[model samples]
Target: MKSAKAKATNYKACLALEVPAYVAFYKAPPEFLGDDALTIEVKYQGGRTEIQKITVKVSAPGGQQKI
Candidate 1:
């Protein structure tokens, strides 16, 4: 387990990629979602663990759609 002292609050994030692509994560102020596959996991300092998986199709801005 990773040890981290609690101040006012704390944050935890981890990323794993099976196939190589591109990934971007936004936090606070101008937060945004992605248009591709991603996985999010949240574990308390020493409590419950919650995970979420998102699947999305991606394409070029002005390219032909996949059929």
Candidate 2:
């Protein structure tokens, strides 16, 4: 199997979501591998707060993977 480092450069990072929802995906640049995670914080109008975060992993070819 190929290693993540070898295939990392050929991949593209992206985030897609509908509006009015405070959900998102974050892909870090290759240089920031040590901090390979995405952080998202949402704040409501009434001082209420919500936060969601996820680790970013490299995706391989030939298989369907969900982000």
Identify the candidate with maximal lDDT: 2
Alpha-carbon error at 40 in model 2, in Å?
A: 0.3
Cα shift from native, residue 24, model 1 (Å): 6.5
lDDT of 2: 0.49
Candidate 1: misplaced stretches above 4 Å?
Answer: 1-36, 62-67
Instruction: Give candidate 2 regions above 4 Å deviation.
Output: 1-19, 22-25, 28-35
TM-score of each: 0.33, 0.41
> What range of 10 consecutive residues in model 2 has the weakest lDDT sum?
1-10
Model 1: what TM-score?
Answer: 0.33
- Report the lDDT tens digits of candidate 1 across residue range 11-52: 344243233333444332233333555676766668999886
Cα lDDT computed for each candidate against the true fold = 0.47, 0.49
RMSD of each: 14.6, 13.9
Q: Could you tell me the lDDT of residue 50 within candidate 2?
A: 87
